[model samples]
Target: MNRALLLHGRQYKPFKGFMEKTKQVWLVVFLFAFSGRVAAQADTMARQSAFRVFLDNDFINLRGHGSDQAYTNGIRLDYFNVLSGRRGLFSWMPRAGENSVNTTGVSAMQVMYSPEDLKKRQPDSSDFPYSGGLTASYSLHSSNPAKKFSLRSEITGGVMGPPALGEEMQRMVHRIMGFIEPKGWDYQLKTDLLINVDFTAEKMLHEFGRGAELVGGANASLGSMNNAASVYAIFRAGHINPYFNGFLAQTNAYRGSKKLFYNIIVSPRAELQIYNALVDGGLFRRWSGRDVSKANRPTLTASELNLGIDYGFALSW
Candidate 1:
């Protein structure tokens, strides 16, 4: 009887510890979300429905489950409801294209498939999704360009559909030897939650005659996902002028001076994961992907750097 009680105690101890740690993780997320809201204006963006549609290509996600650097392209439609006036804060619910990563993350460079392959595609590997997130942003656009600013806070959560971005897992051994296309990308469940806030205020420090505005802004973001907090800095420049679009504009950039215009956007960015949690073992596994079993997994984080260029037109009514 004593031995039986001893064994039960051992099991209960670890389970209790895990639950406590999980609570701490959620607590931190809640605090970050609250602080982000406090740092913004009392009012949100203008509730007016200024909707826009966009097609985007992300030459980023350097740490995605797989390699689709060249094939990332998708269309997104989002609506902006002003919570306050332009001065007030606004909220946003955005779906970044269904299975956006899978759709665009296709390996245009290496992998090839026939049209029939499309029909034969398995749902698990399909680029279709049901996902979206909510965001609150505030924009200050003053005549004194220096006073122009854009502040945004976002909490985004969704699933990656399937592990389509990565290679197969059961073939882990063969993949290690580069034998069978080296799969094992998204071996875990594909849901992820990210909480981020970015503040951007620009100054037209330099401009050429009917040319471009050399602008600078403080573009900072902090969020958490995959049991880690993610940070990124954004750099913007060139001929296209940027007007902080708050949550309304989605991804359309334009020259502020034109009624209908297109602009060239060059943005260089970097991201890093810090203070990681080892709730699950294994480096390639996202939070959902990690095996609760401790035998083969270790806590880890990832970092990334990217240079992306965007060209698109916008209309202001």
Candidate 2:
């Protein structure tokens, strides 16, 4: 009973502002009624739970001349056991489970931005990406519970629109506080319309003593993220027996393990950026280089390395 309440509480905090928008509410409904989330992970039917919810503290490390930190908090709702064999909303889709992990669907959303973006618009400052939007995807993996090697993969796509609403709210709050941000520049949301397709494939590099497994993987993505290509080395920590990922639950193979459940996964990643459409001063060009009159933002496709970490937690019946 306590767990049920905990799950409900977990799902509400992220979408508290959602009820104000009818479109977003409908989007939420449509996602639940249709194909599902984590479109890639849905290929198999493992860890057959009707639902799962999770939260993440996500970070991005940028390198180069104007190096600085980037961050975002992510919340996701994953539907695993939603599909029944030949008897569900996706009746035409293939029914899977026996041989691999099949996660039917997923629906999610996130807000991405830098703390500086919220400050008064500074024509002289770096233009960092800031926006929030919805997403749906699929996930699929093949593995035997507790086994050493696991093949896991997924594809995710979505948009984080500009911060028109947030900007107004910020201005209003500043007025109330008698605190005004710097003026003379038009501050805009980092990305007006962003579409991203991300992919990850990894294997169990090794296992820990009765507690956790280490996963190593490579990730690549394309689309309008302005990121032409990204390849990374992944190190993940998860339950040794269940092999659980907060976003994606464990397989039936991990079920009933005698090991006690203590939930936490630390995913440290080292990524090499092959191409980046959004670079340096971000959307603001004059903020970088010597030419204050430089009007055009440079589209960078240079190579760079990034160090990042993901903290995750999971709960299920």
Candidate 3:
């Protein structure tokens, strides 16, 4: 009995130590897993808090060399927020890839066009027409970092012509800036409803080192406001972030620090324009008892092919 008790005591001591060691190992693992989960939650919170707002204006007169013709004045306000999950309205849209980040935006915009001779009561018939548009849009942007691709879709609704308040807005700006007052708004396009849907997709073509890359994309629009399709290629070089990181992937958040970001971009595009409401007038013409054969009367149908190049520099900190 004494020998048996001695043997049992020796085995029990080692067994107890083994059990204690296993508990310590499990505690360490649990702590590590808990901390990792906390970190992931924090990262998600940071991403959710990153909201953006933009106010943009385009005025031909702002540039010292450009004249107030063709596209003259425009203004847009945008609000964007990162979507937390892809369960609701986001699910209705197409995804870029498996690892896609989604963002939603709302924007209000107004654009104006003018003829070369703004002071003429009856502008030349062949010159660009006096037109304006006011539109509000809702959009969804999806980007995939793993695949280096992005997709954007938007729905816009509003009005064109006098109801857009284009003439009023332009005259107000001219008065404030002491510029020549425009006098040819009476022949502008008649009031019409504007509704449109636009879609754009882009993919990375090649990456040249860490600072330069090339991307290709295509865009199409359909509706009463505008109908067009275009394909473009963009070349960007300089200190920049990957194109699929955050908020169009133009910027990113690093682990330890922040630095200035800048890039020089050149984009060339080819477009097939089917119909332009601002220039071709509305789909259904409304007669104002004016002579239809008059030279000043705008046409209700137009289409053209265009090629253009845009180059600019961007900076952010």
Candidate 4:
């Protein structure tokens, strides 16, 4: 009877421990959700002009990830508002200030890991492990704040450090692949250089007496994915309630000028996304880049197609 009692006691202890841990997890989640109340209350009083700081901070948190290619993540933050102070610009059509589409109010980036080390020990978990990068861009445009339609243009550049310990991994992979190939062996290193340019055009529209808006734009890039472009549309479902809005953007990709010459081809990428004041996430499919050499041309393809999620608060005034 004592031995049986001891076993039962041990089982009960584990069950008790699990329940305690579960309670703590719930508490953390509850706190995270409730923490936004403070920000919401402050925003209610500010009327949307003084919330730039919070918006900037949130943007960095959402889009920025560690910089390691094998483990580092990438982040991007963008904002476009045409209703603030420029009411007269909407009266004019087809033409707006040249700087309108060229401005980016907040821009910054950080590198988080080194590629050489990543290959030495491949982590099992899906977290940013080893990578580094730099991001720089210029923001232009904003002659009128109340314009119904606004335009924006931006140029960005950055370099992504190789995956954590990728060189060693590449060497191993090359060795393995070479052993299978006949006589001569060649190794191609995977590295990234980032270059991007984008334009945005936004307009306000009404649907059945409801206040709504439309956002659409195109983006082009070279270093990271060869050539990529995107267009998006967002609608405001709330009236008099500016805090709740919904937006969707569609992105496409294609081979570019450089690829034409190198025979390094890639099929276009396609993506769909939805975002609101509280949440943002998306689904995407891509075609990988090919390697074209003097002797042979290689074709690569996308290896992933899936959805991703992000949880955060956004404040813009």
> Which candidate's TM-score is highest?
3
Highest lDDT: give the candidate number: 3
Ranked by lDDT from best down, the candidates are 3, 2, 4, 1
In angstroms, the error of model 2 at 200 is 1.9
Q: Give the C-alpha miss distance for residue 247 in model 4, angstroms.
A: 16
Candidate 2, 158-236: lDDT as tens digits: 5443432434433443465354442422443343344555545555677665556566666666654445333333333
RMSD of 2: 12.8
Error of 1 at 1 (Å): 86
lDDT of each: 0.28, 0.38, 0.65, 0.28
Q: Kindly list the per-residue Cα lDDT of model 3 for residues 119-169, writing each as its tens digit.
A: 899767677778899999988888889888899999999999899999999
Over the stretch 1-317, how does candidate 4's per-residue lDDT look in tens digits?
00000000001112112234221000001121222111111112222221221111111121222112222223334342323333442333322554232222445443232221233343322222233445666543433234445555556665544432333443343365332211111111223555655555555443335433333333433334233333434443222222112110111111122221111111122222111000000012111122223111101112112121112221112
Provide the lDDT at 234 for model 1: 30
Alpha-carbon error at 230 in model 2, in Å? 6.6
Off by more than 4 A, model 2: 1-47, 50-77, 82-98, 114-117, 123-134, 141-160, 163-186, 189-193, 226-240, 244-266, 274-302, 308-317
Residue 250 of model 4 has an lDDT of: 12
Candidate 2 clash figure, as a count: 19
**In model 3, what lDDT does residue 181 have?**
86
lDDT of 4 at 244: 15
Clashes within 3 Å, all models in order: 22, 19, 0, 37
For model 4, the run of ten residues with the poorest summed lDDT: 1-10
